[model samples]
Target: MAVVNRRGAQRIRNGHPWVFRSDLERAPAVAAGFVRVEEYTGAPLGFALWSPQSEISLRHVSADASRAPDAAWWHEQLRTAIARRAPLATESNAYRLVHGEGDGLPSLVVDRYGDALVVQLLSAGVNAWTETIVASLQELTGCTGILARNDPAARDREGLPREVRLLHGDVPRVIEVVEHGVRYLAAPWDGQKTGAFLDQRENRVLIGSLARGRALDCFAYHGSFALHLADRAEHVTAVDISAPALARVHEHAQRNGLTNIEPVEGDAFDVLRAWYREGRRFDTIVVDPPAFAKNRNAIEGALRGYKDINLQAMRLLAPGGLLFTASCSFHLSRGLFFEMLQEASADSGRRFALRAITGQPLDHPELITVPETGYLKGALLEAMG
Candidate 1:
């Protein structure tokens, strides 16, 4: 085993859980699948996924080097991951069991919506164990089907071949899963990342409670937040760039016999600006745009984008109405997000009352040291008179 430098070993020892190329003592000619990370003194540190391209460089599989990244280990991890969700009896049917590195299983995610499992093999290490992982998921969860949503972009980053196929069981074109008493048609085979945003389950329920009068869901992909508002609010206008996503939302609403949802297909910023210009006011507005900042460099531009949309949303909100805004950019800190919101309120000349500040569901557990893990942050506030 080639030795990893002192700094990398120290970082792993301190529980940061990733080693970069700069931290290596000597380069080992190991395959992309897995390699042993050791200290300069030849002391074994952990097993890591060796990525030559990404700065993440090495994703630690396990601190214990003895544990091989194979079928037996995967079966055990899959069993333990499923067992961890025993408390969520109803939620188990449609939830994320293994959240990549969050569950100590780096570069792999398993989300079960009813009897179907959506898997994302994000790294060479996980991809190597794909067959075993799929089999274990089926045997452990009794899932009727397993769909590999291995999008090409993520695989290319890992220097692995992109593959999308039904590894095991039966996955239909669209699978139905009930979430908080509402049935959601998840298209794992043909839909977005893992068929649905199961991570936002709890947040959507919270949005349902906050909905009132007319609501606007900007970048409301598939209407998870918008559709939830249908039963709670007077009406909902869902805006997204993807016409197909809007169509899916419309389809979901129609399936549920809901008629109060208005699927609007257009750029969120333009639509918000037009609504503001037309003096079209909403009682509640949710600006849950996709990640604007992927890295530190784009943060300034992303912040400006966030501020502009929020400023417009606040301006179009009626007095005492709500503004539920969020940024999924891990690069954007909670303090910075709050500061942006305050500035947006100031720019809009509106007094804002902070009702609640929330984050991703419990499934997406955030380690204190891993601040990047706690990227999903949002505020539920009311525009005061």
Candidate 2:
């Protein structure tokens, strides 16, 4: 049994899944594998996947110490996760089938893009259990193929190699998914975060409903938001640094018969700044940048970047225009995100009222005890002046 210190035990009791290296009573002999977690006094706490090298030494799999994490156990856990998202399957063919800790499958994420399943084994624990995970996912979703998109940098911290491969069956070059009556082609193997940002589905629908006139979607990877906005907006400008991404956006627009969307290849920060200088304004603006703060040390710079982009976005919004802004950095709390927004609103001299605050869609559930699950923070605001 892996003995956890008092702090770790207390945290587990409170429903937190992570046990840091410092919180362990002593390092286990086995560096990377599953173990029965116990308190220093020898009381069985739970079953956890242990990774000695990583800061997150233990990821609790089950609070029931007696429960063995076998193939059947994994199947049941995965089945429950799938059942939870069953309702969402009706709305969109694309949705997150398993959201790591959110789905009680810590350190592993499996997103379903139609017949293909994109899996990310982000921890040594999950990496060790890849066969079981793949088998269970295949059984549960009956996906035509499982693509291991296990190349996220997070795996480096866990001493796992970054790799992308076909684990089972076959995957197409492009897969089509429909959300809110909009069709999009996603490249699960090539595109970002399992082809598309499934977490933003609800937010996109919400923003699409509020969209009007001209819309600008900055950091518009594959133009998911811009495509939705184009439904109501007179025109939509989708900007990104990658030309291929812009090209994909153009293709998607063409696929949807959406002629109003203009895909611009450029850095979002520069594009927003230049657009503001050009005195170009929009009725709707979305700023969904990649994680500016990779860690807590980068928080200051991230806040500055967030403020800069948001301030420019506010400046570019026409009177009564809607603004949907977001930060994906887990280190940046919801409070800090809002704080930056307040500063941006002040600097832009735009009086705005908060229309709604949003997070990842229902498929990506947030654990009340694990605050990090609430990583994506977004706000919808209406410029009053």
Candidate 3:
């Protein structure tokens, strides 16, 4: 059994899943995988995924102190995770089936695109149970295919090799999915974050509901937001830095039969600044940039980056227009995001009425105790002046 110090014991008991290397009092005798966990004083803690080489030494797997997780245990846990998302069938065919720590299966993320599933085994300990995990998921969901996307940087920290391979049948290069009656494509093999940003599924719906007049989707990746906005707005300008991405936006717009979307290739920051200076206004604007802060060290620069785009967006908002700004950076907390928006609003010299605060939809559950599962945060504001 692995032994944890008082700090680690308290942390796990308080519902946090990770036990750092500094908190481990003793290492397990066996290899990297499932092992019994105990307090330093010989009190049983639980069963955990033990990673010998990882700085995150242990990931709490179960509260049961006696038995290690077996096939049945994996089945039960996965069964519950799949069952919880049953209601999402009505909303979208593409969504998160398992949200890592949110689903109580740390370091394991599963996203579904129609009948195919894309899985990420992020930790060495979790990857050790690859066979059983895949078997359980197949039995529980009867998915047509399973793609193992183990190419994340986290695996490198666990001393594990990163590779993308098919764990099961076949996951196509691209899969079509429907969300709130809007159809889009998911590039499961090479797309960003398991084909697309499923976390923003609801936010796209929200933006569509408020879209009108001239709409702008800054950092418009593949035109997911633009497609939705096109259904409601008269015209939409989708801006991104990549010409290839803008090309895909055109393809997506064509696929959706949306002729109102104009794909523009440019850096969102420069485009927003120019638009603001030229007195260009939009009835609806969405600033969903990629994560600026990947780690804690980048938070300072990320805040500045966020404030800049938001300030530009606020200045470009037409009177009584709606603006939806978001950040997917976990290091940028919700409170910090709000504070940044407040500061951006102040600098824009624009009076704003906060409409709503948004986050991950129903399929992607966020626990207050485990903040890692909840990274996407957004705000809906109305330009009062």
- Rank ordering of all candidates by lDDT, starting from the highest: 3, 2, 1
TM-score ranking, high to low: 3, 2, 1
Candidate 2, residues 27-75, lDDT tens digits: the string is: 7788576888899999988789888679999999887877768888889
Query: Tens digits of per-residue lDDT for model 1 on 205-313?
Result: 8878878999999998888888778878999999999998898889889878899999999998898898888999999888888889988999999999999999999
Task: Indicate which candidate wins on lDDT.
Answer: 3
Q: Following a full C-alpha superposition, what root-mean-square deviation does model 3 have from the true structure?
A: 0.9
Q: What residue pairs are clashing in model 2?
A: none
Give the TM-scores of the predictions, in the order they appear: 0.93, 0.96, 0.98
lDDT winner between 1 and 3, please give it.
3
Best by TM-score: 3
Q: How does each model score on lDDT?
A: 0.82, 0.90, 0.91
Pick out the ten consecutive residues of candidate 3 with the lowest summed lDDT: 61-70
